[model samples]
Target chain A: MSKNSMKESYKIKDNYNTSIKIKSLVITLICLILTIICLLPIYLLVINATRNTSDILNGATLIPGNETLNNYKNLMALDGFNALTGFKNSFIISGSAALLSVFISALTAYALVVYDFKLRGPAFTFILAVLMIPTQVSAIGFVQFMIKIGFFNTYVPLIVPAMAAPSTVFFIRQFMKSSFPLDIVEAARIDGSSEFRTFLTIGIPLLKPAMSVQLIFAFIANWNNFFTPSLIITRTEKYTLPMMINTLSSDRYTDYGMVYMGIALSIVPLIVVYFILSKYIIEGVALGGVKE
Target chain B: MASNAQRRIKHVSYAKYGYFFIIPFFLVYFIFSFYPLVNTMRYSVEKNLSKEATIYDGEFVGLDNYKHILTSPDKNAEDYYVHAGMREGFLRALSNTFKIWVMNFFPQMILSMILAVWFTDAKLKIPAKGFFKVVMYMPNIITAASVAVLALKMFSNDSFSIVNNTLLNWGLIDEPIQFLADMKLKRTIIAGIQIWMWFGNTMILLMSGIAGINPSLFEAANIDGANSRQVFFRVTVPLLRPILLFTLVTSLIGGMQMFDIPYLFNPGTNRSPGTQTIAAFIYQIYMESRIKNTGHSGAASVVLFIITAALGSIVFYINRDKDEIAAKKQLKKLRKQAAKKAHGGLGL
Candidate 1:
């Protein structure tokens, strides 16, 4: 109970805290190293993109060389590997697909949530069944269908069928059931607003948060998708960024530097999109965890 | 009463609008998705010549293609995997698929467990945790094609290849490893890239699961004089069982259908040394065989579909809650006992 005894107790507590700190420091170091290992391949990629092909073939090192300008020059020099054209093609396909997909999915979701029609149960079950059928299983028939309708190498086949995005519809329907109150729709109807107008004006704005998450996901799905595109898209000019990046690797006489440069270019937009929309994308995937 | 009747009628009429809203989706689904799905079945039962190939030119063989893919005639090839004096394409693809998945999945699950524990532990006080998470998850978001290409180049036998050069320089090997050409090494590199691309996903998923656990549980453990390791094993992992099962099952489904990464490893080609996935084989048959062998491709798809469905249901069954399973078993036992008693009473 004396002052000297209290000071000695305080010193003991301080010693314990420092030991904890040392333990934490070691844990932190280990995590940092693992994180570095995860990112090191990508870092090597970006650094090598800046180096010439000759330098890259000589050896792989952490130190970045200065051939970025020449790499870009050679990359752009290749026919059909034009970054500008690739970006434009990708934006058009993915942007349109995401927008159309989410809009239809939300519309379908709204109908299912708000109305108690006869086919509502069956329709919901149908969507659930569709969710289990992997897209790859349908690839052959889909490509054949596209070719039958003479829609190959066109964006129509890519963008239009997004209306059938069962997962998106399912997610949005769940969101609506949780958040959307029927009274609001009734109130809007009483206010003389048409159903379509009400959905466009009120329902969409209210559903913006959920829609943005699904939209970003749809964009990424369509943007990075290569297998289907590779099947249907025959022309070089019609190629999306992923398809273009693949070509960079598989070309007969390949330039590793140029390929890396192209890969770097393809990923930058996604990383930018992630920084902007990562909060929602992460939350969306987590939301799916609870659903499962 | 009359006004109420009128409102009721209008409301009933308004209900029809549901049909209006859903029609576009159903229409597109039926035309683009459902139609093709059924058509794949149709294509599965046909035969044609490489049929320089026009659509609708093949004759229906009625399960011949299925038979061919499910049974191989070559009993002695001197090389390649054979079972029952034969090698089925479907079986080889099934085995290859599982081999690649197991190679990546077990290691990924363990590593992610450790990382999830590290980053989520407040006591660890890991610096720059956000930055690390973002970097680690970078590969998952990037196109699989790019990852494949980068991996192929990195693991190649070239003197400048990082994997080869590093190992060679460290005197770990006498010569460069033929990562691309060697059968085992090819699968290893593919599996390694898959692990690289996905471990972060599994980690993030596990981290979310950890965060979802009640904080009071950890406090109770602490009060009981539990150490961090004890808390992790006893308090944390048990609570994370559902999430872990979720991750495991979803990854199983995803890994089974893996195509782009393997295909991109060696594009425009029918064969890769050791990296042929089921989905990749389907793509190869559909692309290379033209119109004549459409049934063969369709058969492969059917096989893949069956595998995915069967495995998915099995995983779900395996991961069913223990309490629910026990309760169901008890109910079944009670029903049997009741039935037996009724039968004995009837005999009396």
Candidate 2:
């Protein structure tokens, strides 16, 4: 009786048909295609950098070309543009904005979560209110203010304001609620550490994950920021990478080879950073998934 | 006992330290954020000759700039505020902005929702889920300027036009289509890019919403013999309402401020190429060093702010769920009844 039942069950298992397997195969193909679509443009960017301008007129294929050195030469010879200076300026601005904003925001988050302060509720509410106010509203006056205070055409306007990023502060506060505990601060206080010292030694280390996430976000936002800088930085020498790419595209005789090369160069840092922090970015999305 | 009480008071007074930590944020915000915001309002109503000119030097224009935005003095299609002849007018730019946003947003939400649901569906047995999520999000991280340049180069009716060529290769068209030239085509292409760049972001938000749902709920639905579509609509969609509202509202705000791609491709136009947005209009206004219409730009920015704020509030109001409100009321009533009963007897 047991053997017969075993045989019946085996027959039932075998009855699962080819149609289901084919369905799964189709689903796999669709998913793969979606991934490829996401990835293909970037591949095209890299591939196009190696092809000639005129040669590509016939229609550039996904296939690799032998014109990489020539395109690099073309990019180097492009007038009124310096990739090196743009990269340096971009790095300085984005790096400063990221570090300053994240640290200051974390500091602010630490304050709001750990202590009972006067105006705490109001200040937190103010941050929430300002988060709704998009940057464009004040951009006109910001540029005007920058000009009035002799701040235009300088990185001060770009880097300093990042110190008060309310969004970053809010995000860090959310992370702290779940991950950071108030008792840890009390423990440090009990052990006779200074308040600021406790934050540095105990609070910051715990908020590292949140810090990196905001730092990358702040960095990307600052790096890709073309609007404000376009209004402020009129000179070529002070151009950020995005601004440089815009200038390259807007030129009268836009060189396709040089443009592609410049674009490829601009995305390389972001792509590299993404590869390193891809896991964190995906995870961080969920972390920031819900608004508190 | 008095001394111990005083010591306790002092311990709690360490709350003063909170003020110290919080002050820097407020201070910086006051200078960089608050001050500019107030200054924007002030500048919007005045006629400043140039930014180099003092604020006091400018005449009070009252609502003239704002009025100028709405009631165009010249109904001419080709009228420009500055020598560059870029700005079409405030209203025209605004309409164009909305036009592009509407074209882009509907498609974006629909596609993002489908992609989000499909990728996260458990029964799908999707492969390389992590890889796809990361790659899809890659565009969001990269600069829009670079992406615009890539898009234009690939799609332009030139020898370097990969898209045009592919169509020709596949025998889809006899000639390379003028993607950047035709106004309608240009708007569609611009909208398409916006969709491409943002769907991943929306998908992740939806995925997080899906992840937030309890697994037992899905299991229970399965036990009831609910198919994927029914489960999605009945259980998942209802549970995901807040997330959906958040995405939709935020996307609208973002769409209104859509500048980078259109600005990159079609700079300093009023509403030319059908791709011009309000942001580009404002930027163009500021860029006009020749005319010095900062006040007009300020007015336009104010308008943009109002539109976004109004939509954002609507988001907040809708997201306040009705069932939750009723549940809270019921809980309060039950607690009140329990308290009365306890007072009447030893039912603690």
Candidate 3:
């Protein structure tokens, strides 16, 4: 009787396995379809960016056409499309913002984690609170503050505000708590290393993964920031990529191709950055997920 | 004595270094964020003209601007403020904001949880899971403004729109759908875009939660002859409670503050009240404040602060309750372990 029952159970298991395989195949197909849907806009944008306004208006296909180079040339000829200058401004702004934000956030995280100080809890809470206040909430005040401080229409307004990012501080603090082992710090202290020296020489080096995460986030935030620049920086010369794209789209003459090209160009740097630090970015996001 | 002197020196240096390490964040916070925040509150009460000119000319009109914006009639002598509108514009914006929040949150949460469960299943040999994750998160990195523009082109009312063309070709609809032109459809599309942009983050969070679950629990269930569905429902969902609650609260707070997408979608004109959220309303007020006629943007700012604070606190309170409950369970487990050790045997 026991042998018969075991054989019957095996048969049931085999059938279940076959059904599971069929279900898995269906789910995988659905997931692939969803991925394609998510990528559709990107595909269309790339295709349209290459086509001229006439072709775009005339219902272009998903495939590339002869107008790719012509559209790019036209886009380059536009007032703000001096590729050299545009790139220089974006690089300087995004780079400085990322560096400043990451450095400040790291130091803040270090203090919060390593030091037992009064107001640490409250400060951490305040940082979390500030994360909920959207950038638009303080836009009017921020713009006015920048103007009053004589940083209007320059990189200072663009870069300085991002330096004290509350979310970055919060994220880095969490990372430091989990990843920065106390034993290492204790060992370093035992070796007669000064706290400042330890941080600079040991802590910072060990914090590459966290730093990369913060750097990518800061870079992306600053790179795509539009409203602040739109409000504070009226000069065309100082416009970031997003602001430049906005100008291209909203100007009296709406050049669809140029706008698409500008949008495409604006996103390429981020994609490249993502590929370079894909490992760190994925881990950071995954870690952030668990903590939350 | 040598050790004591070394320790003293270390203590002094550590304190000084701590201050040094903290100075950059504090200085930047004061100069950039905190100062501006305080000034926003201050300016909400004062009157300003042009870039350089501002005065505390008005008597402290506490909540008058809020009342006016929330309760005032439009120039056409119609009551523009809906019942839900407090502090500015019509109430429809607030309702619309909540509506979009509802539309996006439920589906996104459910789908993410389902995906997380499926991805973690042992039977699945998902190839390049990491690659898929990166691709999924691609939309999150894109600028909301650009995404809005792309959506506009793709959902255009014209026949050239890919969505409409595809639908027509498939005989899904008799004619082209006016996606953005219609108010309900526009809001739905906006919510859809938000969900697509946000689900990857949710999926990642849920996946992490699933990963953290102890495998032994699943193994035990399997040994007991439990089916996949039973094991998942019994173990996975319950273990993911904390992360799920965290995501829910954060999503709630973030959803209430939705701005960038809606603003980009409805650029210059306020054509559809359906799409205008509280953030967009605030933007409109700020823009209007630049003109001489409308001098009450500061009031709108004050209103926004109050609403955000109220909502944020409520959500925090809800999350805190769940956290305390979890803490209590952990404490109970610790006590039980201590009792067992004291007794030198497991309780019957």
Candidate 4:
């Protein structure tokens, strides 16, 4: 009787293992299909970028065509959609905002971490409080104020406000709370370094990992910012990538290839950069989420 | 003498430098963010609007903008149609925003929760996990402008459009559907795009939250004869409350500011009435409209702000460090007891 029961339990365990294996296989297949759905649009965007308007009108195709140069020439010739100018404007705004936000956020986080001041608690609390306030709330007043100060149609509104990125400050402060050691600041002080100099020299090096992550995120955010820039900038010459892309939707554009190429140009750099740093970017997002 | 040196060393204050380091942040915040927030409030109460070529900032109009936005227009007024139109527009936009957000959020939460659980499950043995995550998150990084235009092209009303052509080839229907003309379909497409862009992000976040849970708890659940579903509900969801709350609140705040996709999806000068969001409404009134009604837009901005602030405070309340607060209270009580003992049980 004991032998028979032991065999019965073994048979049950084998059945359960087989069922678990089947479930895992089914999940993998579903995930694979979802992955295809996720990437299909982008893949088609690239394929369509190389095809002519006639071919695009016929139907979607999985393969590319020979109209790559034609599409490039047409996109370049398109009015108010200068890819070069768009790239320059986007780069300038995103680069400046990223640098300003990361550096200032690091400095603010450094102060909060290293020094025991009376207002430190209040300051950190203030950062946390304002972290959830979306910029759309004050966009109208910001635009009017910019217009009043003769700062409209310029990069000032876009770049200068980035110095006060509460989210980046909050994230970096959380990062510093975990890993940054205060003994280095003391060591530098013992070596007779000025406080600012110590921050620049030693504090920054220690905070490089956090700073780089925030810098990338800030850059991506500013690069993709269309709402505020759309409100501020009116001139075609000052248009960012997104604004330039918006002009493509106007009824005049019948050339589907050129339009697709215009989009491809805007996203290709970001895709390439993402491919290289996806590990860091994904980790950064996970870190930000868990820390919250 | 050594103790004196140590005390002097400690007295060398770096607190002053803390203020110095933080000066630039505060200065810019005041000038840029704080000032504009207050200025927006001011504009909401003032008669700050333009008609035709005339820009008007005449005088304070106490609660007029709010009343116009919130209340129905009088039928006897000369511009009753315009007033009713604006009132209906605001309410519709508010409702539309809520509807689209709800459509996107519930499914997103459920899917992300399931995916997160699967990704974190030890027994799943999922293949190419990292690649799947990377591909899924790719949509989020793409420019919303491009995504919007891309979706527009794919779902364009013409038969030659990608979706229609594919459907026709598959013999799904006799006629190509007018996706753009139909308001319900348009809103669903927008919500679909939002879900596509955000579900991966939510999944990754929840995965991190789950990964933080102790493995021993899962083992204990297994040993207790609990099935997978039972383990999930009885153990996982309860411990995942804080992260789930954080996700919900942040997603709601973001949904309130939904603009780009819905705005750019329209092929015309104005956003479609069916899918106009609050942010889009505010933009059209303040910037795009011929009248440029700053008063209404500002009022709407304030309303949005109040709602966000209320939502944000919930997160703030949830994220308070309970352990630390309790520790502080205990220390205070002990200090009070010490003082009481020194005072001979409060004889004084």
i-RMS, each model, one decimal: 3.4, 3.1, 3.3, 2.1
Residue-wise lDDT of candidate 3 within B69-115, one digit each (tens)?
Answer: 56754555333442124333536677888899999999999888888
Candidates in descending lDDT order: 4, 2, 1, 3
* Per-residue lDDT of model 2, residues B1-348, tens digit only: 545544554566678788899888889899998899888888889885664664546789798777667654554534335312333466567777888888888987887777788777766666778887888777788888888877867777553478888888888988879877788788888888887888778788888888889989999998998977899899999999887888778888888888888877753233353666888877767775566767788888888888888987765465333554698699999999989887886655
**lDDT tens per residue, model 4, B1-348:** 445545655778778989999999999998999999998888889876665423335479888888788889999987577668778989999999999999999999998999999889898778899999998888888889888988888898888888998888889978999999999999999999999999889999898999999999999999999989998899999999998999999999999999999999987464688999999999888887776677889999999999999999987787554664798799999998888899995567
Worst 10 residues of 3 chain B by lDDT: B78-87
Q: Tens digits of per-residue lDDT for model 1 on A9-114?
A: 9999999789778988997787778778877887898898999878887677899889888888888998867777878998998899999989999899989988
DockQ of each: 0.46, 0.55, 0.44, 0.65
Question: What range of 10 consecutive residues in model 2 chain A has the weakest lDDT sum?
Answer: A15-24
Q: Which pairs clash (backbone N, Cα, C closer than 3 Å) in model 3?
A: B82-B91, B85-B91
Pairs in steric clash, model 1:
none
Better of 1 and 3 by DockQ: 1
Per-candidate TM-score, chain A: 0.88, 0.90, 0.88, 0.96
Backbone clash numbers for all candidates listed = 0, 4, 2, 0
Where is the poorest 10-residue window by lDDT in model 4 chain B? B49-58
How displaced is residue B77 in candidate 4, in Å?
A: 5.0
What tens-digit string does per-residue lDDT give for candidate 3 at A1-292?
Answer: 6999999999999998889888888877778877897787888888888888877766647886567787678778887555446667878988999998888888888877786666665666666666556565566667677766678778887787788887787777767777898777767777778787788888788777788887887877777666677777777787666666555444344567766777777666667777777777777778762221
Model 4 lDDT tens row, A1-292: 6999999999999998898899899989989988998989888989999999999988888999999999999999876789999999999999999999899999999999998898987887888788888888998888888977889889899999988999898888888888998898877776678889999999899889888988888988888888989999999999999998988876578899998899899888899999899998899888852221
lDDT of each: 0.77, 0.78, 0.72, 0.88
